[model samples]
Target: MPFLKTAKLSAIAVAVVLSGCSFKEDRNDIVVPIIDAQPAQSSKLQFPQETQQKTKTVPTYSYTVRSGDTLGIIAQKYLGSSQRYTEILALNELKSSDAIYVGQKLQLPTKGLKQPDELQSSNSNKKSSDIEPNKTYPELNELVDSQQYNQAIQWILNQPELSNNVELQEQLVELALTQSKIYKRQQQVADAETLLSGLISEAPLTQNNQKALISELSTLKAEQELITAKRFADQSKFDESYDILLVAWQQVGQPLENNILFTTTRNKVSEHYHQKALRHYRSQELESALVYWKKILAVNPNDDLALVYQDRVKALQNKLENL
Candidate 1:
């Protein structure tokens, strides 16, 4: 019994040492790491609150076109440059700058920021005193006084400096008058009238004796209209010629025979209107033909050709109605 007990005690000591060695091997060879649920440092991906942006709303407004309000003038008032008139055209969906009429409503584009070059151009335009007109006007005046009309016109057009100078503007109108008179003498009536009319159109409100000048220009213009109308009638451009005479006659209060030139042109256009009516009649366009015949009778009830054509068209219209 004592030897059996000794053997049991020795086996128990050996088992305990084996278990200790197994624990030591686990400690030396295998490892488990501790993990954290939260980060140690703040994230670099986070943006500052101030860096966030909100959407912006664009602004818009409406405008009305008053009399004498050109696109350039409007642009100058609002956008700061006459050159920016094209921007207004795009905003309004207008095909041409000339399409706007008095009392027309235009959509104003007020949001666009001015480009650097455009701002510079606006500044340059506002500072036209940079060009000393005193140095330039004497030579231009000499060209006018000497009757070098073409040269004077070319010089005036080329110099943007002369635009706002009241003294130079008056001289320009006088030069234009001289040019028109010279053109009339040369029988270049179209050129004469155009120059005079353009001058009157652009003349500023502050000028002296502007009404008298306009009256003189109007008389000359009426005479040129008659001359051009006669030329058109001779070329068989009857409708175009008559249209010119019609405008002149209306301007002069639509008198029957106030001036010999007007009377002559009226009679000539009356015959032409009758001819145009006959042409329309030959093409079986009796209704259309009656329009020109009526115009002829309106100008002169005594027109024999117009009376005949008018009667013929009315009879044809009656026949068609009966059928």
Candidate 2:
């Protein structure tokens, strides 16, 4: 009885001492319990954190998606142009018709538009003081408001008022080239992540470093999903991809708008859409297919494939009208 009482007293003394040091103990406590009671979610939590940090290196804005938020509205609110929504889709890995649930995330960037500050200032420069829409702009900010920044500088070269503003026109061309360089820099990170995925193996491994590997692989998996979605107009059998690409074509439609970065690969996207349109047209989706072909011809007026498709679209239009 004496030993039992002494043992109980000893246990109580030990508990009082341990509780004082419990905070320190928790620093290393229960790191991914080996017991099957709670599944290891540490890696799941770390994956998004790492990817979010990685994207911060680019000139992008992070937006937490709210209910009823479409990429178009986000673009209009953040970038001032609803037309730049593809930039949102590319950064966020959203699908054409996936119907974003509440609590989704998005990334906003300077693609196809100016910074928010610059957009506001552009409007200030173009007040009633300027008589002509085509007045020569010494700086990129001139005459470019939020809604028009995407088209503002380029409009100078085409407008009648700026016909003699050769010096300002040339400056706009130089800055357009700089924007292309920025675009390439953003793509480099995406490419590096793709390469990392190929190097990492998915084979089951020891628990020691599995958590780290799982974290890396989850981000790579999301990147792969986005890249795959980029390749098709109807990814996941949705019909919205064609319209998305249609908007992209319009952003860089005319040869006048094409710069070093956009010019070299100008035909690439157009060509991709041209074939996608044919595939859809053959399936009897004439309107959808014609929509794509028209976008292709927007960039290249004489594009032969689009020309052929246009003729067919006209014939179909006539037939439908007669019926």
Candidate 3:
């Protein structure tokens, strides 16, 4: 019986050793209890209000009113429809469509609106120095189609890659021409001329493009002079009007000089000045009369009426001085 007890004790020791090996084989199972004991104390400590406060605010977008930015154009650019300009009017509490001015900051709708960087990234495979012309052209055309000429010009100028883009250079020239015509139509002659001149100086225009821009500039100047002369003549400032017309005639050449509007305006101004000269001559204001006659001759150097009147004025002056 003692021998049997000794054998049973030996069996118990073997079982304990085997159990330790099993535990060693399943060592990974011990980690669960340790993990459970240390429950996420930090998560429990987090306040709901603090968590809410940490949540990000919905972002908004805005645009600044640049030169030549109309509500329709702005809406087309930012909101994707020119017709949505009314939304801008409502948002800004603007009573008139004409109320927005350059440098005004306007908040844009967030929906469907992307930041400029996001637009640049998603629209084109752009590198630091190069851009995908195909993708970029459509974006530029949108601004052009909206008649946002100045903004389009600014956009093109800001793109450094456009400098080497021959197609874009040509497009810029065409866009400038179109914008100049619009400015001329609006009677903003100076603006039209300045826009052309600036593009001529800044753009890498082809020879033909340069010629076209220069020609347009000349025509614009002539048209402006004619308008100013007509306005002065209407105001009865005949001498000033005649002087302006004379300058325009001398400056412009060929078809422009022979333009019907210019010719008609010049004749009207000259005749008005002639009538004033006649009045001065009859009133014995010889110096004033001579001044008008001489100006008329300066414009036409071969005017029979002006030459005859000028001679008569000089002869009369001599006679008066002798007397």
Candidate 4:
């Protein structure tokens, strides 16, 4: 009986040792503490709003009916010139030019109008440094497309190229702007994934690498915004302005003081509105035409087309009233 008990105790010890050896260190189980946590969204990675409100406001007036206040004098004071007698007559609802009464109330009108224009500088040193880039970009594209990419690249990479070459400058400006934006975007993406880098304490030993993959994906999305902005600008140029503004529009956010693209585009668009106003007058849509004409006059009162339409409409309305 004593021998049997001793044998049984030995068997128990062997069973315990065997159980420990069979126990596997769960290699398949994963416990990722570093939360891959979804990538954060930023407003910068969004489409910038287009179509800002006009900054200029129409002039308001407060005039007094002083003694010996003649219409010609009123025109000169308010209109910046005394030759606008007609404007005063129209504003005051006077039937005759000679009719004048003492102590009468009159709100004067200015026959002349001036609107904001592109600001200019006469300083030569400042002027030389201000010019658009990408002037040669289009030409370079043309050359490259024609199987002369090496020559095109070489010309663009010139150390001291022509300053007056608008096309070449335009391309360089656009490329520079795009590259800068991309670099900034990449930096932001890297910042967003800064915490993920800590998870890879020792790289080669880990078999599962899902967290690394997620980080890379987030970076790629940030890059998409810049590409999207460029594509939209390109599309707008293709549709409305064409090659006239394609490069300039893309380089708009750059540090370009001398760039005429913004002013040129504004002028081109304003001219289009005036042209539409003229067409409406031709179609006899007088009231609708008048509204567009006013906008044109507000932008540029000196426009002959707007002036012609304005006079013709006034005559037609006067004739109708007489009948």
Best by lDDT: 3
Taking all chains together, the TM-score of candidate 2 against the true structure is 0.25
Can you tell me which runs of candidate 3 are displaced by over 4 Å? 1-136, 159-166, 231-240, 254-261, 269-323
Compose the digit string of candidate 2's lDDT tens values, residues 110-217.
Answer: 555545442356645753323233343434355443324335535544556433445544433333333333333576545444332332343222342333334444
Q: After TM-score superposition, what is the CA distance of residue 196 in candidate 4 from its true location, in Å? A: 40
Misplaced by over 4 Å in model 1 are: 1-220, 253-256, 298-304
Each model's TM-score, in the order given?
Answer: 0.30, 0.25, 0.37, 0.24
Q: Taking the tens digit of each residue's C-alpha lDDT, what string does model 4 give over 206-309?
A: 22343433333333343334344335444544224423233333333222213343334434544556556656644445677687666644433333344444
Model 4: lDDT of residue 143: 58
- Candidate 3 local Cα displacement, residue 260, angstroms: 6.2
lDDT of 3 at 128: 22
lDDT of each: 0.55, 0.45, 0.60, 0.41
When 1 and 3 are scored with TM-score, the better candidate is 3
Judge candidate 1 against the unseen true structure and give its global Cα lDDT, from 0 to 1.
0.55
Any runs in candidate 2 off by more than 4 Å, and if so which? Answer: 1-260
Residues 1-323, candidate 3, lDDT per residue (tens digit)? 99987775455445434433221222222221100122223454222453323322445466766654556556556777544655655555443312344455566667666445424555357332222233557878777667677887788877777667767766677677778878877878888988999988887667877787888788788876787877887887877887787777666643453466665666666676677777765454568878877776565443434554565556554543444
Worst ten in a row by lDDT for model 2: 27-36
Descending-TM-score candidate ranking: 3, 1, 2, 4
